[model samples]
Target chain A: MGRRIAQIICFAFGALLFALYFSQHPTARSLNTAVMIDYWQIIFAITLLVGVISFVRINLSNIRRGDNRPYRIISLVGLAVMPILAIIWGIKGNSPFMWMFEYVQVPMQSTVFALLAFFVASASFRGFRARSAPAAVLLTAALLTLTSRSSLEGIVPQFITEAADWVRGNPSMAARRAILIGIGLGSLTTSLRVILGIERTWLGSDK
Target chain B: MDWGVIIAGLLTLAIFSFLYRDNPAYKMAESLLIGVSIGYFLVITWTNTLMDLLFVPLTQDAKWPLIIPLALGVMMFGRFHKRTAPLSRIPIAVLIGSGAGVAIPAMLEARTLRQISATVGPLVTESGLPDISLIAVLVGVLTTLVYFYFSREHKGALGGAAKVGTYFLMSFFGTTFGYTVMSRMSTLIGRVEFLLSDFLRLTQ
Candidate 1:
């Protein structure tokens, strides 16, 4: 019963939105904007709340089980503290919430991303072997691109940068364009399948 | 005392400690990062999305249409329990359905039609000389598409084209990797600069 109603709602909304795209009428445009902007944001925000709740629940269970209890407790503390701070001091510029964000979240986040550089370099060293003809071509292209972007551009011959630019503009662009077209066609078919009820994977179960 | 610099610098070093080996410091920093990031996003979403978009409009302006999404959003909470879990599907359906609907026309126009039109133009120059670069691009596109087409057994001419396609794909992958590494290195440089200039006061 629930599944059928869900499917009906999905089809109705999908069809309405699709039809709305073709219409240039003021009412149609406004309705489309309202759904896309206002309703979408509201639902998305609620969905995020639901996710945070699940995160808390999972951490609580882990703590109860004594699996990495200290780490889990720290996580829970961090989670709990942010909202408390926000409620007390508010999220304005000089608030405790913003302070935590600037000092804690932003620094750690960027450092984590920056850490990827080491792994990528290590991975490339191990994996970027030019044993075959195609691999050699790939290596050359990579070297050209890297050098062109790096400090070596000033020292390297002018032809190297020109070659890299050509590779980027011509061959790279062509492959990307083909992939994009393929993605578009694939998306169109999948969307049609979804709207037509041919795809039920998102419904979580066939039953 | 500059507590911000001290706190941020310590956290950054704790994360960087993973390079030596995963220790207690790294684990704690990682845990705190995950929790704090989620918390930050939660607050932002509440302030920028829920309060501003849903609550303010609904309460102050009395926009009754927002009640529908609010109810749908509430329905999402049904997932917390087993029996009521299926009720969450309704809202999920709406999100997925509308997303797919919007994507169809957008994808077709931007990705397929535009790309095709762009690719299928002006193979020759105005002076009647052959434009080799344009020719190469056309061939690259056709061959790449052929490589992706799995309907037939790749033999004879198809095999040849597919082989050529692999070269173009390899070039694309190589350039992409180069760009990714460049960006990551830039981020690493930024962190180093922050540590030296902002935290340690070693460089200006």
Candidate 2:
């Protein structure tokens, strides 16, 4: 019974929004934007709260079980302190919250992202092995591209760069468009499925 | 002797230490990052989204229609209770449905229609010679589409075309991977620069 009602709401809202996008009517457009910008924003914000609560609950349970208790405590403290600092001192540029964010979060994030460079190098070593004909082509193309786009361009011939550009302009672009068109068609089909209530995976199980 | 820069430098080093092996410093730094990120998100979302968008407008402007979505949002918490878990589907459905609804038409216009038009252009050059690049692009697009087409068995000519298409696809992916490596290297370079110039003060 509840599932039926949920399906109806999904269909109604989905169809309304889908139709709303195509409508040239000012009222429909404004209403769609209002629903998205205002209502959906709040819903997504509320979902974040849900996420935080789940995080805290899981960490607290972990702490209780003595699974990495010290680390869990640090995580909890970090979580607790920032909001209190934000509320009490406010998040002015000089506030403790902002200070922690700037000094801690930014550096950590940048360093983590920087680690991807090492991983990519390792992956490329494995990927550009030229184990087969197709792989040889891939390896050759990748090597040419990397050399052309790198500081080694001075050493590499200008023709290498020109060939790389040609590859990017024609083959790469065509493949990209084909993939894009596939995605567009797939998305449209999925949207129709959702509207028609044929797709119920989002509902989870009755369990 | 700014404390912030010193702390930033230490955290940066601690995070990079994971490249050697996972240690207490890296774990602590990782946990601190996760917690701080969530905390920061919560505060920002509360202020910029909830208070400014929902609460303020409702309280000050008396925009009562906002309550419908608010109620739906609140209903998402029903998942916390076993019996009421099914009720959470209402919000989930609304979110997925609306998201898909909004995406489809825009995707059609941008990815499908625009792409087709972009591909279908004048094959002749300004000097009246047939543009080889344009012809190559047209052939590439059609053959690649054929490569993805599962309806027919690739036995003869279709197999030959699909084989060529596979090379084009491989070239595309290889270039993309190469570009990714360059960008990632750039990111690493930025961190190195920060460490040297700002943290260690080794260079200007």
Candidate 3:
């Protein structure tokens, strides 16, 4: 009895909403879907508060278990202070929330980015190995690209410019277009899944 | 001397102190940052999205249309419970069924059919050999597709084609690596510039 009702409701609502999007005529189906999308967003907003509660609960439990976690307390303090300050003052161009964003978020992101240098160095070392004919060609192109002393020399030797331009225009363009095509397909598939609700893995469950 | 710059400058120094060695100040800043981000997302969703989009409209008018997603969203919370979790299928089925229905035509047109059509054009023209760029594109498309073909072992003609694919992949990866390195260097430079230009102002 329970599952029958669930299936009936699910199929009817899903089909109606899906069809609404394709309809040329003004219909209740389209209007209902538009409203439902907005309401779903509100439910997601409530989940944010739930997330904060979860965070505090987990960290507090960790501290209680003799973890000696002072950093968790620091987190709670910032969480408490910033929201209160923002609520009191309200966020605008020069408000405290904006202040925290510019000062805090940007710096931390930059720090994580600094680690990329080390990773790139190691990856490049592996990539530049002249182990095969293709590797040799890669090494030569990379050397030319790396060593080029901008203005006058390329003008002096037409062939150098022509060769460099050829490498950039042909092989590089092809490679990049291939990448773009793959990305476009992947994104299109993802968007399709989202709109259809077929890809509910993002919801962390069947729902 | 400005208070905005001073607080930011101090925070930057505290955060970056990890470069020398990890310590209390860095840990404190990092924790505060994580906590603030959680709070910020919550507040943004409440004010910018929820209050504007859902809460006001639902209350002002009896938004019966919203009842479906609201029910679906509630069903999603069922996963938290042990026994009632199977009830989550209602929402999941709705999501999957609708999502697939909408995406089917779009994906067919945009990704599969468009790509197949793109490959069907003339390979060689009267102007000369087919456009060199087009030839490289065809090679890349053919080779990469072949590279992903796992059914047959790379031997004989397959081996030669696979070899070309491997080279294309490596060169593609190599160029990507260079671009990533340059971008990372720029990030570091930008951070240092921010510290000097926005925070300190003494370097100028």
Q: Highest lDDT: which candidate?
A: 1
Number of the top candidate by TM-score? 1
Q: What is the lDDT of residue B202 in candidate 2?
A: 100
Query: What are the DockQ scores of the candidates, in order?
Result: 0.83, 0.74, 0.40
Cα-based lDDT at residue A174, candidate 2: 83
Q: For all candidates listed, what's the TM-score of chain B alone?
A: 0.97, 0.93, 0.82
Per-residue CA lDDT of model 1 for A71-161, tens digit only, reads: 8988988988898899899999899999999999999999999999999999989989999999988888889899999978999999999
Q: Candidate 3 residues A51-100, lDDT tens each?
A: 67778888898778857489988788778766786898887788878777
Task: Provide TM-scores for the models.
Answer: 0.98, 0.95, 0.77
Per-residue lDDT over B122-180 for candidate 1, one digit per residue giving the tens place of the 0 to 100 score:
98899999888889889999999999999998999999999999998888888988899
**Model 1 chain B weakest lDDT span, ten residues long:** B95-104
Name the best candidate (by DockQ). 1
Worst 10 residues of 2 chain B by lDDT: B92-101
Question: Where does model 2 exceed 4 Å of error?
Answer: A153-155
- Predicted candidate 3 versus true structure: per-residue lDDT over B1-204, tens digit per residue: 677667666767777777667799888888888887776776777688766766666788776666666666666666567677766666665654454445555555675566656655677878867766667767866676566566899888877887777666656655555456667777767767878988878587
Model 2's DockQ score:
0.74
Model 1 CA deviation exceeding 4 Å by range: none
Stronger candidate by TM-score (1 vs 3): 1
